[model samples]
Structure formats: structure tokens, C-alpha cells
Target: MDKLTKGTWILNTTKHIVDVAQKSTELNYFETTALAGKTGVFLSKLVADKQEVITYEKVKKFARESSIDNNNRNVKMHLDLLKEYGKVDYNTKLTEVEVYCFSNEDAIETTADIYSNEIVDEDEDINIYSLEETYNVPRKREELVNKLVNNGYSEEKVNLAIKIQDTFGLIKVADNILYNEYTFTGNEAKMVKTISNISSSKKKDIEEVINRISNNQGLIENKITSDINPEIVKLMEGIGLIDGITVTSEIGEATFYTSPHIKGKGIKEKDFSLADDVFHKAKILLSCLRFGQEKSTYGRGKIDTRTKMLNIIRKLNRGEWLNPCTAVGQDYKLLEVDGVVRVRAFGNRFQMSLRQKEVGILVEKMILNNSIDTTDDMGDICSLEVQPSGIIIPEVRRQQMKPKEIGLVKELRDEMLTILRT
Candidate 1:
């Protein structure tokens, strides 16, 4: 099998790759995924600016602007990394480059909607579970196509839908079989029912809070009342519908809450053991993102630092620990003086983790307090099932969020917005 070269740093600077990958620092399990994230922001901007098929030189210029490893060689490596992750489409021949565009596409009813609604609205005798089973069970790609076609969808449209969903990482097609990764089961299915059962009297307020947290990643616990009634929050918590992870620092501590369905990566319901490491790693990544924005990493310039930071944060997956070198390269030492991050030696090399774990939740609170907008890339590790109307299981959606559903989350200022606010 051919070896992978994109996600790691090639130490042999003398050797250029897209050609060879000898003597590389592999990022397979050691948490260097942030480099691809950083590179994604660059690709987003490059596509936005060029607005057409880009050239090789444009990619190089953007790479040079990055604060993370801006060498000529690293540019090629970063592009390859993004390509592997579905962020860009570059021609290896180096003439025409097509990057994944970040612009929002108009909301049109999707093929899932078209087909699923056709069956249900028409009152077909087909057992819905049978239809769902057809989708959930891994089957030959040809079989699924024939099923969709037999159900009356044009073969061409069905093929296009499969292609689009595949590209969006919503499904996986391998060896002629289709696997839908967005299939909701276990706790995720339970969440759909929980959210659906919210009392109409409180639905307006509660769904607002739940939807906001689900969209913006999560919220600090004490801040929940600012958006909804305290009694409502208590009820939700009592029912195991919502929970939090508390992070501490020398100064204080704060608990961030969200439905278990939308909590950041690695955090699980009833899984307190992972919260410490998960939030701690989130803190380091958040701090490093802040540092990058302040230093104009990716050219954020004199814009709102919190918003800019969130933009890059949205591009990143919070669960992946930042590479120690990547952290230090972002000048994490400056943050250490402020007690934001901690650095220590491990074996022959150094390791970094967030000392001010409170900073992660605090920054999230700040963004809420200031009314900063979270971009489409809200950076939450989990995907919410956000279909407007459909059978919840077979047509479950992921990653995509509707604008009206994204409410502005608020922070508890002076602890005045406590759960007893009403």
C-alpha cells in the first residue's frame, strides 16, 4: 500500500513531496489535526478571493501568508492534507485548482426530502421501517440506486443525490456498497424524541436555548437562565436531557452545558472521566486559536478578535489535541505568562495543555455576551439532526444548520442570570 504524506511534517526539507515523504513527522495519532484545520481556513479564503479556478501560484501565496509552517515545501503538503479531508480539489498537473467553496448555498429541498416525502405524503402502503432498513443496512450501491429508482425517482437525480451526499461526508461508498454515517441510533435517536416532546408553552424558550447550544457548540451552565426559565433548565437536567463539564483554573471555574447530542468531541453523557481531558485539550486549542487571531494568523487583521477566533475555531475539531510544536509555534509561551496554557517536558520532547481550563468556557461566554455570530462552521464536534420535516430516522441530517434555528446564546453576567432568574 502507498504511504500517506499529507498530515505530517516532512523533516527532510531538502526533499520535496507530492514526490516523496521520507523522514516525516507522522501526525497519525499524536494530535496534529489542527494543521489541516488551519489550512482549511486558508483554502476557504483562497477560494473566496480567487472566485474561480485558482492557479498554483495563488495557493503558494496564501500558504506563505500562514503563520503555521509557511515554507514553500509545506504549502504543497498542506494542500494535499486538505484534499484528503475534502477541503479542496486541486489538479495534480498544477494548472487549474478548484477549492471547496465556503459560500452558503440556497436552501433547497434535498433528495432525501423529495423521496421520503413522496412516500409519506402519498400515503404509500410501504412500511416506513422497511424503507429505513433498506437505507441503514449496508447494501450494494446498485441496489440502493435500483430501490430509489423503483420508488419513482429519476435515476439521474438519485445518482446526483448520492454523489452530493458522499461529497459532504454524509455517506461513504466503498467497494460498491453505501454506508450512511449520519444514521442516528442509540442516544442520538432519544435526543430527537426529547427535543420533540418539549412542551409548547416552553418550546419557544427551551428549544431556543437547546438549539442555540447545539449550534454554537455549548453554553456555560450558569448562563442558561439568561435564555430560558431556571425551572425549565432544572427539569431538563433532571430528565437527563442536558448536562455539562466543569473546567477549573486558579481564579475560578465554570460549567458548560449542551444537550449530549451536540457536546464537543470525546464528551459523552454520564462519562465524567473524559470531560477533564476533553475540556482541557479544548482550552489549549481555543487559546491557540485566540493567539493566532491576535497575531493576524490567517490575516484576521483589526477585526473583532472573538469573532475571528471563533471563525478559526469553527474550522477546527475540538477533540484533536493541538500538536505541542504547533502550540509553541503559535507563541503559546506568551499565554503562559497569563496562566492560559501549561508547558512541560515529556520524555525527550515537550507537551502542552491548557492550564486555564476556565478560559475555554469563558471565551465561549464572551462570544455569547457580545452577540458574536457563529459562522456556518460553528466547530461543534457532534452533528445535530436538523431536518425541518421528515421521519427522524431514515432521513436524519448532520452538520448542516438552518439560519432561523440558530438563536443567539447569552452569558450569565455577574451570576445574575442564574437558573433562578425568573
Candidate 2:
């Protein structure tokens, strides 16, 4: 067979050559296959003539003779792959292309050399590149793959590398790449090392702490000692896991709470209260009552209505007496009677109340401790007084007030005021 036809026949028969080209050039399967067909045709001519070098013009001539696209554009595109894979040495400025013998041995050696020589410094900063830009550009893909592989990662790690790149950008990943030894600074590095050193059980414990903090929207870092493992706490501090959270260390110990600005999702400061434990219990009871034995709603597929009701409960449980003006509940209307606060869910009117004596004691303590302001004349009017029938709510005369003033009295209805005094 003639050289051109022989080349085409060899390309069709040998698939491994195309696979090598694909890996070396970081091209997709199809592009590398097409380029391999054209390359095989070109190689046949070089082998037959015993030539090591071909001018750019000769490349086009050979392409036409071999029934490959003869256009300079098509020939140049195919030649680019050969150069990238180190199969051929072609310079953009020079019009000559030097051919290397097509063999798997040569291909592997050359690509490995290229990778070793081009490996980036572990500390080098990588400019952020969007996934689209990296995928579309062959050069960028090769650069990433080479860097990752040369750093001791296998081909299987490519997806993981991409995910890291997407999350922290290439710069952070490069900084975090473990070389001969771990080289990083600050809390994040320390935390990573700490996590690596701990047992799997401890790791799970740490994760649980994070989940609890996340679920509670946040907690005082000090108050977090209850269920958390101490080793995990050390790791957390090392990693600055609670960075950007609200920190209040004055009240005996450092308190770390969630900040809406940082975590995107966390409990707002206003949503938390001393009665959080009680609110949580009440929420569980209500959810259980509403969902009953239904498996779906009780688990991962919980309804939004349940979530909203829990939030409302949290807000109401902030130890604030719900007068008519501020008694707005998203899915429920709140009622205070005899020192007990009741929540009636809007739909189905599902009702639940806090422990009556516990709530009354808390409210009384708050008033006596002056934690809640009772300085207004209205406060004097409703001041707590010891009576035979329990703490009695002082009366406000309707006739002594103007029309708008009467509305204020009406808002603080007898039942709500009675709860406050009691």
C-alpha cells in the first residue's frame, strides 16, 4: 500500500495511540480521535520517506494526498494536537515541524517529561478560572491536569480536584496541596491537621457538633460543651469554624451565635431566647401531633408548614408578652391566659401551651429583676399585686382615656395583662 493509505489503515487498527494522544493533550475523546486519524496519515509519509522534519507547506500537501482535509486550517488544527502531545515539535513562529517516531514508549516518556517540567509550584497562586473557561480551552485543562497529577494525585482524583477548585478556587487548593509535608498556616491548616490525626469516631463527633451548631442557628461557643467532644473543640478553634459568628464572651465564657450575614442560614439573634429548650420541646410535641405516625412528614420530607410553625414558636418564646399589636404569627395566633402562652396553628387550629407554672415563674422573675421595662403609666396600671385569687392585674378605666388611648388599653386585653401580672 502507498504511504498515505498505509497511515490511514494503521490509525483505524490502533486505538491505543489515540488514547495516549487524548490523555497527553487533555482533549475530549472525539477531538483526539479525529486528530489521531490525521496524525497517523502524516506519520506514514514520514516513515516511508525516512524524513525527521516536514515544512508546514509539506504538511498541507501530505494531508491532501492522504485524503485528509487539505485546507491549511484543518492541517494546522491537527498539527496542534501532535505538538501538545509531544508527538511532533512544531513552533508557531517557525514553519517547520519535527516528527518523533510514533510509539507508545516515546509518547509516555515525552508526556511524563512535559508534566514534570511544567508542574507548578505548590505555593503558586492560580487565578480563578470558571469551569466553562477551563473545559473549553485545551491549554487550561492540560495545565490543571498536569498540576494535579504531578502533585501525586492519580487520574481518579481529577473530579475531586475539580470540586475543590470550584469550592475554594485553584489558589486555595494549591496552597492546601499536601506535598512532602503539610505546609499551611492559620486556623484552617491547624484544623485540617487536627482532623486528619483524630479517629473516625472523633471525626463524626466533630461533625455532629457542627451540625448541632448549625441546627440551633448557633450557640455560645462556651455553652457548646454539653454534647461536644473536647478534641473536636480544639480542632474547631484551630479551623476558626465559628469565624464571623456573633461572639459574646463577657457572660462568664465566650458565646458564639449564628449571624445571618455570614452563614446565609443561621438563627438570627432575635430568634433565640433563654426559653429555647422549652420552645424546642413544644415544637417537637406540635410536630408529632400534626404529623402523627406519618413516616414521610416526620422525617426528611417534613412539610414547610411545620418548619414555619417552629420558627413562629421560637419568636414567641423570646419571653415577650404578645399584646394585640405585636401578636402577629405567620401560621398561628398566640393567646396568653393565666400566665400560660398558647399557640393555635392557623390551619386545623392545632393548639399547644408552655408549662404553665414554669412560664409564670419565668415571667415573674423577669419583671422583678427589671429585665423587662415596666416604667410606663400603663405598666403602673397593670402592676402585679398579691391578691387572694393569685397575682391580680390592676384595672385601667376606659372613660378616663381618649379614643386613641382606649385602643392601647383594648390591645392589652384582660387575658394578656392577667398573664403578665400572674
Candidate 3:
């Protein structure tokens, strides 16, 4: 086979392995971390050999040689971002995800600093900050509020500040701890409703946390990422074997540790060769096992519906409602956001919205029940707790079209239709 065709076949092969590995890891937490760390090193070496810049073609070449599939998208995405944003100051606005994806430490730090910057008090603004900065400032809103009170910021002001911070950005709070980062004109509340981390005040013992998480059904599934198990890490660290070290995460009674082993020589091992080996081994082992597991067990979706519903509400602060699938196309194009949204991939396919789906089901229910006798009363939501199938068709009357219904449907239909077109 020629080079291009050979590379495509190689990528196709790698994708299958990755898909299987993602599925089987039950307690495969340690493995993925090792995989990431090792992969980072491997990529870095390749970059170093090429004088520090890996183009899309080079990455494709590497993808073929390395037998890894995920980097394909990362390479393209990073190149696009670098082309668009260029080299910028390190800030927290960019996520760890974007950081690792790009293999750009400067970019990662720029984004990190942006996210980690402290929240300002009520009065401050007119500075340019990212939605990332806003969402992450009040990361642990309740805890930050409590911390503010401890800082003598006053319970009344601190609580109110946190509430606003949760909805607004860090710059918007009237009183900010990040005084150094000031602008001429104060324009706080830069963005609204961004995904930031949550801080939990109620510290649970490892045993307590594990028990709580285990018993909470979908609560653990929804709130906790499969990649993490904090309780497990704590337990492992508490054990005497590994010491004088650092840990990145602990999930479900599993702990990840990395530290140089001290020897008789005052300056023991400075290199992380041992740690590197261990990490890669853990990753491959986990990858194999995770690849072996059943889909239902691995998937978070199989959790108890009630628990899933409750946890999602608490986590996202909103209930999920599915709009009925009036048209279930062979292809689904999910609408991630409205307005000018950046999408790496776009095409005709199935569309989905978490809470929006419920509305469609309610509409379908009205139609199926024959409650909607006329087209003018076409606005419907089909809530199907009763039906197992996800086929939620709206109850709009096909018999006749009211002027108002036609206009409304035209607008709404276009919205859904736009996603399908893409």
C-alpha cells in the first residue's frame, strides 16, 4: 500500500484499540494517567527530534508510526488554535485539556493563571477576562463564601458575593481578592453560565466518602468522573509504602503516586525513570482490563434514573428535558450551543439537547393522547416517563395550520433544521 492509504489504515486500527480500551477499565484509573504521562513524554521526544514543531502531516506520520488515534484531532485543534490565537500569555482561561492537547506549556500556564486567579470583591471591572476565568473563580462557591467569611469579609457580603460569582465571573464581585489584576473600567460579570469546578466544604473521611459515593447510585456516576477516585488515592497515600512524594488524584480507593526513591547517596535519583516505567505499565494494564469489561458496567448512563435525575439537577443546577425526536434521521447532529459557536466537527446527523428532549416528549404525549384537537394549540412537550423508547414526536396537528402556529413552527423548525443541515 502507498503511504497515504497505509496511514489511514494505521489510524483506523488505532481507533479500534482506543475504543476498546476506553470501555474495559473498571478500576483502570491508574492506567490512563500512565498513558497520558507516557504519551506526553513520547510526543515530546518526537517533537524534540523534529526541532520542536510537529505539523499536521508530521502528526499523521507519527500517528501511523505510534499506533495511537486520539492525537489526530488534538494535532488539528492545536494547530487551529495556534493559528487563531497565536502565542498568548499564560492564564487559566484555557483548560488542562487544551493544555495537554496542544503540548504547549506556555499556553497551558496562561490558561491556568486565568482560571486560578482569585475572585474580586463586589466592585471591579472593565478588564478583559475569559469565561473560563469567571466560571472557575468561585470554584468551590460555598467554600469560597465560607473562606471569605473567615477572611473577615463579613458573612453577608461574602455570601452575596459568592451567589453573584456563581452566576457571574470573578471580576464582577464588588470586593475582589485579586486587587493586583485591575483595569481602568470595571466590567464584572463578563460571562454567564460557564462550567467551573465546585468546591465541597463537607470533608468526608475516605471511608465515609467511598460509602457515600457507593450508596448514592447515579450521584457518584454523574458527579464524579471515571478518571478520578479521590477516596482511593487518600487511602493509598495513607498506606506506608509510598512517601516523600506527590499524588495527582485518588478515586474509588485507588491512589496514584510519583516520587523518587531515596538512596544512601545524599542526592539520590533525580530522574523519574522508575516513575515513568510504572506509569506506562499501569496504563497498559488498565487499558487491557477496561477494554475487557461489559458496556453497561462501564457506562455511567446505566445508573438508576432517579439518582441520575437528582444528581444532574444538583450538579448542573438544572433539570434535563429532552425535546422529542420529531424526526429521527439516520444521522444525528447535536446542537452544542447557539449563536456563533466553534465546532471542530459539523455535518448532518441526529440532534440532542439534555433538558430540551423532555419538552419534545411532553409534546409527543399530547399528540399521542389526542389531547391536541387543533393545530393552533400545537405547542407541546412530550414527557415520557411512561415510554421506554426515546421516540418523542411533538403533538402538532398535521390536519391544519394556524397562522400563528405556522409562524412559530417555521422559526422553531428552522432552528432544529439548521443543526440537521450541518
Candidate 4:
């Protein structure tokens, strides 16, 4: 009972009930119920203060001292009323009492706000930029901006840095700087070396020019007179060393590199355009099929096989020829003639002919067979209609398909079919 004296009244209603009960000559039934409600509130606060179990004897004693009804019947009746209103634990026995906290809607909302404010205050003190200073980076974009600004970097610089981070990747940039190495190869290497010999002031100019180029979508006037050495620019333009970038005396245009390009060569100059197109199509089709398969119950080995096939296609598109051992569960020989690359399958179980042709058909057939094999029915896809885009395999009809799966199937099927025909 002494423990209740230390408890703070969180709700103002507790005071109002006491004042009204004191002023009234005699409390009616309604006033008695109100007094019980106030007692319940006090009991909850007392439990919160104790931070331990409250016994029925202690609660009953506290109620008597507080000038409320001390009779066992009245106390039990009020306790049951509190339980009915969800103010206290409904399962609380007569011997033991457990106060339910934040039981009121208002109390729950107020508690939530208090917790939210505490989290915000703690976050405000954290410096989330400059991993060297903070030891961690903020995951949120707004916090990242604030942290960079606090680290003495201008907003423009922070914006540009974020763009670079997004483009080349933060880890890649860090690796290059830490290792004191360049990722550029072939003609790009030469350009880097040439730029390295420039004066410090000129380097700053080049940096500004690059920033402008990035911001303007690769279109900018050659304004950096000192930074951009005319001789180096002319040399780069003459040798076709710059890919996805063009510089004129009046205007310079730049584009991000989506596909790998060799120095001194453009994508149009390569004779593997047909193979490239077919390979891209096959990749899309396979990716769609893999997505569909993942929604259903798929074996881990089948997923691994699908991922391997995608990697092979990506490597081939990057101008790297694959040996038979590099392929997944199949033997392949990559042959390049007159800049046209063709993949020939050796020991192919399905195709009898050993003749080497375009890699598109081989890839398509390999993926199709692999997909069919993983399914329960061996000939399930055999009856599927082959359209110009690709084969339309029926989806496994099951209640397990979620809304997300439905959307994925529709999108992949549409894109896959479109690419297969082309």
C-alpha cells in the first residue's frame, strides 16, 4: 500500500475524481463507478512504478487508505469493472493483480509519440556522412545530405559525389583510390595517363568539365581552356578512344556506357550485331522464365543453372569468348571470325548435327531444355505453342500464387514473348 504513494498520476482524471468525491456530501452509484475508474487508473500507475507484480492484498489496502470503499465485495466489483473495460488484465486472479499498461487509446498514442521523439533526438546527434569521421554512412538520402554538409562539403559537391557514387559505385571508387589504380583499360588507360601529367589547376578544370558533362547529360561547351589540353582532346578524338563521349570545340556530348566497348571501335563497327541481338533476347526470355520458376517450388540446382546461363550471356556480350568448361552443364566453343562471334555446342544431347551456327539458337534451346527438365512433367512444354516471341508455357495453376507473383508472371510473359519473336 505504501508503494502506491510513490506512483505519479499520468491521467488528470484521477485528481478530478478525488476532488469531486471530497466535495459531494454522499456519492451516488454513478459517482461510485467513477471513483472505481479512478482507482483502476491509480492501480495501473502503481504497477508501472513498482515494475513488478502487484498482489490483491496490496491493491485492496491502497484503495482503503485512498478513502475508496474498503469492503472485499466492492473492491472485487470495481476490479471486475476495470477488467471489463480492458483497463486491467482480464485473466488477473483474486490472489494476484497485473496492471495492463497503455490500455487506453489515448495512452497508446501518447506513448508512441514519446518513443518516436526519443528516436528522432538520438538520430539528430549522429553524424551519418564521412565514414572516416562517423564510421558509418546514413542509409537515408536526406540524412546523407545533412551529414555531408556538416563535414564541410558544399551542397553542389555533395550532389556530384552522390552521383558519382551511384554511377561507378561507392565501393569501386574507394577501391580505386585506396589501391592507387585505374579501372580503365586499352585507350582509356592512355587517356588517364595523359590527364595525370596535367597541372593541378588544369586538373581542377577537367574535374569541373566532367561535373558539367555529367549534369548536362554529356552536352557542354569546351569551356575549360587551361584544364582540357587541346592536344589531348584532339588525340583522343582522332584515335576514337572515348566511348559514349564526344567533344567538339563548341559543344561536348557524353553518354553513360551501357555495354562494354573496346578502344578505337564503335558498336556499329562490330559484325556480332546479330549475335548480340539474339543473345540479349535469349537473356530476357530466360530471366522471365527463371522469375516464374522462382514463384513456384524450384530446386536450388535449377536456380543455379539459370543464374549460370545469364552470366555466360553477359560475358559473351562483353566480347569475352567462353570455353566449353566455362559453360553450365554443357560444352561450347566460342569462335570469332571477321569480328562476328559464334558459339558452337559440342556433345549436345538434343541436337545431332555438329555444325556451328549463330549462338542465339543454341542458347535458346539450352535454356528451354533446362527449364523443361526441372519441371515434374518432362513433356509439359512440348505441347506449348511456339510463337514469334517465344514458347508460351502454361503457368502452374495453384492457390499459392500471390498478387506479386501474378504481376510478375504477366510482366515477364509479355516481355519474354515480345523478345523471342524479334
Q: What TM-score would each prediction reach against the true structure?
A: 0.28, 0.21, 0.20, 0.19
Expressed as tens digits, the lDDT of each residue in 56-147 for candidate 2 is 77656655643457777777766665577656777776488887643322322332233233433231112112222232221234456676
Error of 4 at 192 (Å): 66
For this target, which candidate reaches the highest lDDT against the unseen true structure?
1
Candidate 3 per-residue lDDT, tens place, 1-422, comes to 23222222222112223323456532132232223322332232232111223334434443333334536465444334333434311233322111122222322232223222324222111111221222224223454455555645566755543443223222222223221111111111111110011122222332343333323211212233354453333221222111111111111112222111211112223421111221122221111111111112312222223223223223221323223332212111111110000112224422232322222222222122221122222121211111121110001111111223233333332232222222
Residue pairs of candidate 1 with colliding backbone atoms: none
Worst 10 residues of 4 by lDDT: 379-388
RMSD of 2: 31.1
lDDT of 3 at 60: 46
State each candidate's clash count: 0, 2, 66, 4
Q: Write the per-residue lDDT of candidate 4 for residues 309-406, one digit (tens) a residue.
A: 44444444444444342122221111111012333444542111111123334343434332212223221110001111221111110111222323
Model 4 local distance difference test score: 0.31
Please give, for residues 1-422, the per-residue lDDT of candidate 1 as tens digits: 00111111111110111112324432221122233334533443343312356667656655553333556577777776556545567776866567654321100111112222222321121212212433245556687778867987667766665654454333445445554322222145444544565434555766676666664443555556775776666544423345444433333444455444324444344432111221122333332343233332232122234555554333222423333332342234433333234456544444444433334544444344334463443221211111111111111112221112112221211111121111
Clashing residue pairs in candidate 4 (N, C-alpha, C atoms within 3 angstroms): 218-254, 388-421, 389-420, 389-421
Q: What is the TM-score of candidate 1?
A: 0.28
Best by TM-score: 1
lDDT of each: 0.38, 0.33, 0.25, 0.31
Candidate 2 runs further than 4 Å off? 1-125, 130-199, 226-231, 237-244, 248-253, 257-422
Cα lDDT for residue 22, candidate 2: 36
Each model's Cα RMSD:
19.0, 31.1, 25.2, 30.0
